[model samples]
Target: MDIEIFPYRVLGSDTTEALLNDLESLEDVKRTVIHGPRFPKGEATLPPKYRERRVININGEDVVLQVKTARIFLEITMESTIDEIEEICKEHIPYGFDINQDRSNYIRKQQTVTDRIKYGDKELPDELVGMTDQYSTFDDHVKIIKKDD
Candidate 1:
């Protein structure tokens, strides 16, 4: 089942990076995506600290964080793995977070008309199926991490 992790406060770049690194390390975790409000594009007049994009290191890879972390959607097979995830969140997310399991469709389950039009006759991997909304692009919202082979 898919689980949604809602943090009490909006997470910054550093916290998001740390939390995602730990969550991606879990064996039971199949896929994970962070969803949140996008930072404004025009920040020229603002100070550097208020800059929208931040480069965060994940598993030694640098990823540009474009939004503040609002909710994390995780796809997992084992229910017990939620405990481990909670432990990780507790360590990094001092503000607190709630894990919701009641929702049946946290992630999309079927392909839409856009998907059909985007890649006609081509098949999309299961991991890429429901990662983004119809209006948004994958790179704008979805971040895919695979375990080492």
Candidate 2:
């Protein structure tokens, strides 16, 4: 099952870091991807802190966060796990957030025509599967994280 987390406000680097770290710690969480508009590139006058791509720690691994978090999509094993996710969100996203469960297509469930064309006979890792769309580049949107021991 998958759940879409929509925050009331666009999250800054610090909040994104904290939220991702917390989410990655859950045992039932299979995979997570943050999707949103890309940060603007040519803002030389702005402070260095405002520039895009901040490093965030997820399950003790440091990942370069390229996009400001507009929505977080999580693939969890059980529906009951949603409560735990909501509890974490309530703490991090104090403003508010909606946990949408209505959409069954939030995450892709199987291989598509694109996958067959991209890698003809090659097998993909489970974590890398169902991550990208038919028209888009996989690595451009998919950020894979290793689980902490």
Count of backbone collisions in candidate 1: 0
| Best lDDT among the predictions, by candidate number | 2
What tens digits encode model 2's per-residue C-alpha lDDT throughout 23-64? 989999988988888777764567887765666787777777
Once model 1 is optimally superposed onto the true structure by TM-score, how far is the C-alpha of residue 115 displaced, in angstroms? 1.4
Candidate topping TM-score = 1
Report, for all candidates in order, the number of backbone clashes: 0, 0
C-alpha lDDT (0 to 100) for residue 107 of candidate 2: 76
Q: Model 2 off-target regions past 4 Å?
A: 43-45, 133-141
lDDT per residue (tens digit) for residues 70-145 in model 1: 9999889889999999999999989888999998768877877777765565888887776546676667666665
RMSD (Å) of each candidate, 1 decimal: 1.9, 2.1
